[model samples]
Target: MIKSGISQIGGKYRLKNILIDNTPYHEYFLSLFCGSCVYELNKKKANHYECFNDKNPEIANYFIVIKKFFKEFEERRKKGPYTIISRYLYDLLNAGILTPDDMIEQAIQFHYKIKLSFASQLKFRGLIPETTSKKQFITQAKKDFKEAAKNRNRTEGHFKNSLGKTTRPISNNDCGILTPLNPKLEKRLKYVIIEALDFRDLYNRFYRSYYIKKGLTKEVFIYADEPYPGTEKYYGNLFKPEDHQDLIEICLNSPFNIMLSTGGECGIYLDALGDAGWFIKEVYTRYSTNANNQNLTKEYICMNYDIGKVHKMVMDNQPNIMNYVEG
Candidate 1:
């Protein structure tokens, strides 16, 4: 798999190690809010169709350009696509001689701007912006983060204050890691479906169009990793208690096999999924170390499935998920 080096939300732990092992590869599998985590799923050879979707068009376009950029670069280059070149075409785009109307440079710029964000959670959890060196930015960003984790009482939102000046300008380097593609991975990319659409629209379209049209005989599974329920102040303004209810209702009605993951702190998701005939399983993960230097912050992974069968799958496959966290 062409692994992305971005340290994403779920990428903080060994969830992917277990997720890839236990996750069912249906006739079609889709990651509804995939950021860079798509690489983890693609690590294994696809037995069926694979898709990743996000509501952000910039994100969607970023993937499209990534494929294109890699392909073009691979033609002339000996090894493969690793770096995004800033050439005359890039200069033309910057000079406004050309527009971002479906161009590769525009996509790179979109990715660059997002990287200026201080942390993976962006303006939501990160209290600061990357206006300075990464080390400095993280130092300031963790002020409120440490506070929230320390007390467990106060809600920490976006941190907007920083005293340091930017050491250097944001560039292609800011985005980092233009993941090199292997031939097998590149071939799979041809089949991988990436879309920009509302999750509900994606759900409706899959059932109404692809599900009905494809003659394949296999089950469909949806792993909806929504914003951890109570972390709304951190993960952004999407999955509140009401939204959690809506997500559960949507999953319950769908014909596809579903597994939803959230923090045990999300009482609403746990209660609703547990009550709705979905098996509840919790995986302990260390989130961070305490002010006293002991690793006390435990993040829970609550999953809804049939424990009778999947319990073994979880233990055998994802053993180390409980052992470590990115500190």
Candidate 2:
């Protein structure tokens, strides 16, 4: 899967081993909290229409920008532009330059800063605006320097060198700039449909309309990776208890099939879903102890439809790694 350029919660790592097998009635697929997982799955499908979405605008825009300018970015990379661009941006920011009017330049700045920051958490979430403080800017710019050292592909965060060597920081060594420098296969996103809108709007209008209009033998499957309640949320988009209930209700009431991945829904969350015929299966993964290290954790996969009717949709809870490559 394309990394989607962010350190997402669970979608990326759960792709190969995820137990949800809810099939669509037709060739159309709906990735509710799309993130990076859907891209990998889409690459596998021969012919299918997909609606990939994330409720978070930043995440959505992340997908949208890559889809739009990846080709143009590729052309620039071929002409050896990033070495200059990456270093120039880095130097400008390190010197406490704050220019936001230039859109492309700003985008590129975000591209580099994000990769370098911890866990890809560079949204400036829960943080205040930038004052003209060299000290503050330098504090942030240091993260960019660190990212340059870990030159993982922009479409990926898994870093390892061919010679098992230390990744020395180069002048133009930003991960995002270096990423599109590659042939752009994993991140060849279809920009036409990727959007940054609220999921409720997408579901109520776009998806619902499509589901009604396109009545076929195949089903429409939605895989949502919503923020679990009571966790320190990413990007400042906190999920309330009622929000989870509403999401479950919406999925339960929809004419299509959906799979939701979340943490500890408790009786209030699951009982409502269970009463509406939803099934709960526990899926395990790792969360950090200090929020940076992986501590073994468990999340749930709730489906709105019954799998007993479908003879093949059966896989019990089995643990797997984040980077499991199926042989």
Among the numbered candidates, top TM-score falls to 2
**What are the per-residue Cα lDDT tens digits for candidate 2 across 143-203?**
7657655664433666654323444322333344465433343345552366555667777
Alpha-carbon RMSD to native, per candidate: 13.1, 10.6
Error of 1 at 196 (Å): 1.2
| Residue 142 in model 1: lDDT | 67
Q: State each model's CA lDDT, in order.
A: 0.53, 0.54
Clashing pairs in 2: 24-218, 24-219, 25-217, 25-218, 25-219, 25-220, 26-218, 26-219
Clashes of each: 1, 8
User: What ranges in model 1 sit over 4 Å off?
Assistant: 5-7, 10-13, 38-40, 43-46, 72-102, 114-116, 121-185, 210-218, 233-241, 286-304, 307-327
